[model samples]
Target chain A: MTQPLTAGVSLKPQHYADALACRAEGLWFEAHPENYMAAGGPRLAWLDAIARDKPISLHGVGLSLAADEAPDEDHLAALKRLVDRYQPALVSEHLAWSMRRGVYAPDLLPFPRTQAALARIADNVDRMQEVLGRRVLIENPSLYLPLEGHDLGEVAFLAALSRRTGCGLLVDVNNVFVSAHNLGFSAEAYLDALPAEAVGEIHLAGHAPDANADLLIDTHGAPVAEAVWRLYGRLIARIGQRPTLIERDDDIPAFQDLMAERERAHALLTRETVDA
Target chain B: MPDGFHDRFLAAVGGDEAALAPWCAGPAASAGLAVYRNTTAKGAADALAAQFPTVERVVGPAWLAAAAVAHAADHPPRTASLLTYGEAFGGWLTTFPPAADMPFLADLARLDWLWTGAHLAADAPPLEATALARLTPESFARYRLVLHPATRFAGFDDGAPSLWQALQPPGDPPADLELGDAPEGLVFVRPGLDIDHRVIGAGTLAFLAGCGAGESLAAAAMDALAAEPGLDLSTVFAGLVAAGAFTELRTLS
Candidate 1:
């Protein structure tokens, strides 16, 4: 806890043993709380064992905060239980909604950034903070199809939400890159517009170009792209160091391979700190 | 208004392209929507495959993946926790025309679902065999045993349980999976990190059914005896107790 927030990797069940045995300094782990919502099982047991020694972050992908309806109480209660049990250093969710009525779509579906949508999402963030008794970092969603009716840009919308809800922002650099390319915007300009002081954490993951289309898909199946790594360096240089995560959800390689990418981020963070 | 944004976006994702036309910056947006559609479908398909490993084994990954996509279109997940999704897949497969040749496929899917349930059920310290010896014969008659939270038992009229059990270990399934007329039972328990399952006899199945129904030990034994006239009640009960199936024994006060 004394060390600065260092680089970490998404904790996959396949890499539990390696994660536990990992000895890199300031190395921590992140896991999607939705995956561990079971009543009891080996998944929770493995997480408990890993949390015993390292800092854990509960990054949620299914809370559906942007849905028109209120956040699911059961999902919130389960998330609270995980946060209470694991005591993760950082808790985070997305700016997108996935559930409509009772049916859930696994992807982080987007919504227009209008004033009404902002008010609703801010209220959801407030409710989430009140229930968890802590502030959470809301992440930017990777854009696929651009939508109309938006009253604010993505960065402005995030900043406004932060101002209203007293929550922090998780700047996902890879999401910024993919969204910019797919939506015809400048990634650098988008990152620059982010309120640096409101930023509490950073996320770096992989993306692939669509097979039959020119759009970029946030696949998270491969290693962090070089372009994303460069963006990570640039963002850290601008905003200083924050806890960063290297996420790979599909086609997961060996634990050592992920750690190597994590180590690259760690090295950059260390160098940034030295330069400062 | 933004209130209409979600509805339109959802419609566009659901293939109502014209609904989101105003939102589309250009023609590139159409391909972008395809990415979302493909990703959502992949998510549901992956969850179904994970939940039903035995089904995947029987149908193979390619076949299962395609069926999963079709099934997901009809039955999307109701919760973000995909671990417990695909509850209706087993029954749905029974009506799937492709599976008409495999009558036991639905039963196999049901067993797979049970396995998932057992794997994720609440964890508790299992009861020891010594706990059972403390009860007097009179007390045992009125005492009801509580099965562990991870306990799952089911009876099959065909040899599906045996087929499912054989397919568990890594390798090609048996060359000849002839559907026999033998009625069998399977019991699943997760004493520790791993889920273990085994096939059982009709008497044991009846005993488990009675226990699950909160029947007294004496009554459960009677039911077991009736189910299999030559049942060794003591051995069957002792085996279940030794398997760490019971969590506690409560006397009905």
Candidate 2:
């Protein structure tokens, strides 16, 4: 029987042996699907070996769902291939655009929150679900720029998006704290406003203060910060338990170190399960 | 309420701060814009560094990063799959003025790119020596060898192949990054998970080229002999078959 995914860490190639060997309770793994989109290779072999023992999640980084144009067909096809191969426990992407007119930027780019964007992103989400033949979770991006022209707040926009497309939300608590800090809003209020039932998954990662500015950049290079953990507590307290993931993409430590943080999230989740 | 806020945002991120003036709500846009700029540059450089490790080792991190930044300014990634990004990076290096002093850098990049290709190629059961033994010695001349799906080979006019092989792990660092005068060839093959690579000779290169081009075994043998006399034809054939180089041995009907 498939174990219920409680807490997970982003899988890295360096720690494949450890990831496969270590069998902690409710321990799963998540990987950026883009990295494994090749035809066949050692990477695929490694993923196959790991997925045999644990539930896997395919978190995409470059779908460009909110681009002015539709999601790239080839990208969608590649993602579908992985979904079919892995049969992951969860699949998620960001609520931001990274491609502009066939030219792709690496980062999850920001856009002015307007009525038109909401409609476009909703349509894009519909297309993605249609192609994958499954519901996907859309996570809010960490904001750095505050631009003009917002027809609705982010929470309302996300809530409406879920209602329209029958999709779910992957609420990244660190993003809430970072965006709230950069744009001068209350992170607690933002988390409190999210419709609890709409959240299907949660992401917790670290951030670094920009060297030149007072803003915090979503670097994902350090351990989870105290403030972000507080925000996570605030979120899960209201939303109940969800499949939480610890993401560390840069300056990665050994497998044991990441599992240490994963254990914290796991402990909280297990406690919630017990309390319920 | 402009029609193309996406376009304006794209322009702004492309380094034209004036394009976002109409929607500028605050004066703190400098740090944010700079942040985005830095992210984009970092993303491209990181991808390049990951894809071209050999090139980085030759040129060092600082030079590779600077070149990666300059290259991305004009040639941003065309697709979201960064695993195969920098397809033109090797060719582009030839145009870089700083890289002019290091002509071998481009060739090294090409070899690295080929290694990646072989690593990601589709899996197939390697051709075995036993399979070749099925055919009679006389009838083998009428057959052709089909190259493996995961087989990648490159022949250089100089010793770039040897230099690349020496730089791979589990080996001591070479004394210098100088190319040799003699020509050399490199072949990468993966029958299973682990990839196998080695320096080859002109005769083997010709034989493999013939096999890749669907030439008859006898024809390929002629080409190999023409490329290099005194080449042990039987020994080279058996070695290649053992290395998982060919997928099939077909008769040329």
Candidate 3:
């Protein structure tokens, strides 16, 4: 197996050749495991070629950890097969639900953080870790609405789940910034309240201002904003240097554009490690 | 514990504006549920839409998206990974009231489903052309062939495959690419990770279906010729091997 990631970009098909050819120091690639979940295709082939060169991270967007039930067995089995085949350095899923009954919603859907919800999510995470046979990093989901129920705050809930299931955290700083802005909370407090030791990775991505609301949307469509870069720096300062990624899922810019953003993250991560 | 979080959440996601009113207090709160609902529906619809793009292109995004949402509601994903989510959508659209007029939509969905199946199938080695050439004519007659792990095919009553292909970039078809009556069959095989597809005629379809049923080459070819008389037996037999359709050859004693 490869070593842990240093700096990475979400591997996009358009940027496959560039990702393969680039020799940026400690740079790697991450992909949505769901996208490559095929029987056979060029997507898998490209990933194989890339994995041969750089460490890969299987970031799952569709694994609904907060669902009212255990993670789907077949889905876990499929993911385990990918883990076995690729032997990716890291595996992670979100702290949200996108599926229920038998239909799947592709977006990460939010749920009220309650003790019952925590127990259920922990069970799901346990199932995932059990199947994949490794510790997974559960990301803090971006909240869009502030609802009425909660047994624990988001940070506390994540902390409890990590303690119970032995999973670590994949803190997306941009999600923190976006959710904090949307739901009326301090992003710094949310990041600070997290159990620092539980964090294995951090994500820095761009967001778009919701045309309708005053809130900023976690749309990985644009370049990382200056505020998010500042937030990422603060996070690296507090959490120490973890594997940080620059995520751009939609309206993906040129490979160089992403590399430039990644370069910024790498510089910050490098400085934090040196300073620490 | 809040009294109706689950019920209200579901109602809000289902697009009932009033369901989220109790909890959402401010002016923009009504829009909050709308975002969640839109995001949820779009997620499911988009997954369906990606899987069934031909259907979407054939039926337009707005119409197919609405139908996809309904299909998702009936068969909400049982798993978190939505990669293989819409196995029931093709069948669901057949009975869908809006799609009742377009019988071909179901067939198009069937092709999409098979495409997905082929895409996700296990990897397998393709039978080499040299291996088939080594067989004696008589031996070839008795040989049973196994297809590649990712092999998938379906025969439609009309020219859906041609229409599907025509819709590919270079063709750039218009809204309705007039469905014709040429019976067509599609075969998707992944020798490695690349899913290659081709449109075959009645004879090849019959032969493939026979081989799929574990029939020997002679028997399968006979079945193919029977389906479409005067079918060039040599061309049909050679075509299968050339396409990397079958992955293994064996003599059934």
Could you give the C-alpha RMSD of every candidate to the true structure, in order shown? 1.4, 1.3, 2.8
Stretches of model 2 off by over 4 angstroms after superposition: none
Rank by DockQ (best first): 2, 1, 3
| Cα lDDT for residue A54, candidate 1 | 93
RMSD of 3: 2.8
lDDT of 1 by residue, B1-253 (tens): 3246677777888988778777774667788789888999899988988888888887888888888888988898988989899889999998888989999999999999999899889999788888878787777688988999999999999888989988876777887776768999999988777888889988999899888899998888888989999998888888888888889898866
| Cα lDDT tens digits for candidate 3, B12-46 | 66767567666664556665666777677777787
Candidate 2 lDDT, A172-267, residue by residue in tens: 999998999999999989999999999999999999999988999999999999998888877887889999999999999999999999999999
Among all candidates shown, the one with the greatest DockQ: 2
Clashing pairs in 1: none
Report the candidate with higher DockQ, 1 versus 3: 1
What is the C-alpha RMSD, rounded to one decimal, of candidate 1?
1.4
* Model 3 residue B10 distance off true place after TM-score fit, in angstroms: 1.9
Better of 2 and 3 by lDDT: 2
Cα lDDT listed for each candidate: 0.89, 0.90, 0.82
